[model samples]
Target: MDKSNHVEINGDRFVHRLKELTDAEKQCLESQNMRIIPKLKAAKLEKDAKRHWDIFYKRNETKFFRDRHWTTREFQELINFDPDERIFYLELGCGVGNMIFPLVEEGFSNFYFYACDFSPRAVEFVKRNKLYDDNRMKAFCADLTTDDLFDSVTENSVDLASLIFVLSAIDPTHWSHVATVAYKALKPGGMLLFRDYGRYDMAQLRFKAGHKISDNFYMRQDGTRSYYFTEEELLKLFMETGFEIIMNTYVQRRTVNFKEGIDVPRIFVQGKYRKPLEGKSISTCEG
Candidate 1:
């Protein structure tokens, strides 16, 4: 199929495509299309995300993402470190220290958290947070797509790193660069956890015609942008960059409204990749 062009799905064209498709394939396509409404809503969410930190901090400051109360449960379980060991945690695209603040307050000290984002607003927000301290937390603004993270983090020093819904916002072509940086920055056996939008996700099907900012990328009315990914594409990008997958799962979450009699399904691909220990083959384990 020609990915460059959009698929038109009016009544006649839809019926034609249905005739050509097998029953199972037709069902899948219908499922994907069912996400159009949610996708449109999510697209509108992009505007708020474009100058996300700026608008958020201006109005609410650090209180916006303060629900870091959930970070220890959601993020900490992925770390392979002992709480007593001095660990280095780096969050690429760490906007406003949402995860950092929660982790610190959870009493997980003896760790240095290096947080960075490309947005200056994000950097300032992190710096201004009450939990931020030079001794334990460091915040900076850097574009991970093209810049070198080594200037901010020592090579092979990080014990745990997270991408957390950040990479899908970047141009897909730059995913390899982001993976390369993560590979170089993590210590042997260190973990890289990722959570991002998956292909056929409601967000992808919501795009109206002519919304293309580039192939596989679209801008929502809200000014934030997102790219969708398949498991195959995501696995290939990380593995080719010298990391081995440990856990890769396509997570499906559905929100149901009884009053509206509608079900909103959201899909995300979450993966954990680890840098190989010296002399250890990258292929021996699976993510």
Candidate 2:
């Protein structure tokens, strides 16, 4: 861990908690700067969101995003199992195999991976990756916010389901449905790995006026949208949807401009939520 990114919560190094900052940093947070929804077009754009993401992939061709190399570092349990142990892994919004490929290539190959995304192009890229193997990994297109993940896998077959930076891309109003699907796809005692944009993050604070779709929700210039989540909201959502939070903490880092000698802190909330040994039925939980 870099010294600048080091933060301890409750005497634990990786536990998630809101950060306390100096007066200057606090002033820089700018949590009160939500913009007005300039045009109702944002609503229509959000409704037709699949098109925007499809176009985003077409134009960028996977160049805009970097492969995530931090999953194993942050979630040691994913790679700590015996080499022969059988694991069923599902990653919602698996994008371009950033989390999946690294775990498999770097010694977590004893698992069956089911990765899904809404964009067909993104799914194709994952399939075309040289590291992707059909026998061990399956990348498909599905929208869990409105569809069940089990449509591509057997019920309760997954050991771990990850939603890395994916949930916030969805419309906030539909998150309950997404949670229900994730819970349904996992076996009893299965875990859901979550890491997403935290409230008052630098990215959230950088949004311009007229792009706001809702409080802490905004449509970017490219038509894709995001929601900044607070820890309280995540806790309530997980507990109500039959999850018990195991490791909950925030990751914060300060980036400096050496020439100007200015620093800015970036915050992201990460958590591990476990399904109960006796799980809740979708009917009762979603109700």
Candidate 3:
């Protein structure tokens, strides 16, 4: 069973629980399929993706996203490693060190962290954090959809890699490239952890028609884009990139606030994949 608990942020208690979506929620999502952003605008958004993310970080700094403390609990591989064992852990699209900092604070000294983001501002934020140690971690800017990640992280060298809420930020057409790059970066038997917005997720359903860039993909008012995923499609993406699926499923949660009289159901897809211990080298690029 998935964990459900009451979390208090800024003194207001929010209850989160596992719950299926109600019919009304399903209807709202269906409504989003009627329209999408115009082609020229969508193309421009894709081309200026990095600039938008740069502005996002410049405006929000490190306040928008909370540090991720749930990863160690959700992914046992993170905590299973020996404290002194040397493991190369790579975080693709690591925004502001939200995920890596928590692990460092929790005493994961065994990890040699390599983190990258599309926005240079985001990487600067990570580097400026007090906990960032050059000897233990390398924070850089790289677009996973291209060969930039390979320039910093050698092929077949990473022991663990994570794509937490990262893939959705990328355009679906280049998803194959992201997977291929990750596949090439990991050592045989290395693991990749993934979590991202799921189809019919609250955020996806909330998008007005004009915001839709394509099916399950949308642009926010700030110009940043998101692509919601289904468990089947996400699994197929990594599998076709030559990864062995360990687990893949949807995580459903309901956020409820009594004072605000608000209740929203959220959905996310999470998965774990591993490179085969013995196999031919995974090929680069698909179509």
> Which one is best on lDDT?
3
Per-residue error for 270 in candidate 1, Å, reads 0.3
What TM-score does structure 3 among the candidates reach?
Answer: 0.87
Expressed as tens digits, the lDDT of each residue in 1-287 for candidate 1 is 12232233221010101012356644654554433435554445543454654565466665644354534444444444676788888999888888778778777787899998877787897898788899998898777876557778899999889898889877666789999888888999898878777666666666765455555566555455778766677778888887887766555555567999979766667678889998888762433
RMSD for each model, in Å, please? Answer: 9.7, 5.1, 5.9
lDDT, candidate 3, equals 0.85
TM-score of each: 0.74, 0.85, 0.87
Best-performing candidate as measured by TM-score:
3
Model 3 residue runs over 4 Å out of place are 1-23, 256-262, 280-287
Residue 135 CA error for candidate 1 (Å)?
A: 1.4
| Consecutive 10-residue window with the lowest summed lDDT within model 3 | 9-18
**What is the descending TM-score order?**
3, 2, 1
lDDT of 3 by residue, 1-287 (tens): 22454443343233333335678877776777777688999999999999999999999999999899889877898887777779999999999999999999998888999999999999999999999999999999899889988889999999999999999988999999999998899999899998888777778878876898887789999999999887779768988988988867776656788999999866777788888888555532211
Q: How displaced is residue 218 in candidate 1, in Å?
A: 1.4
| Candidate models: Cα lDDT each | 0.69, 0.78, 0.85
Predicted structure 1, TM vs. truth? 0.74
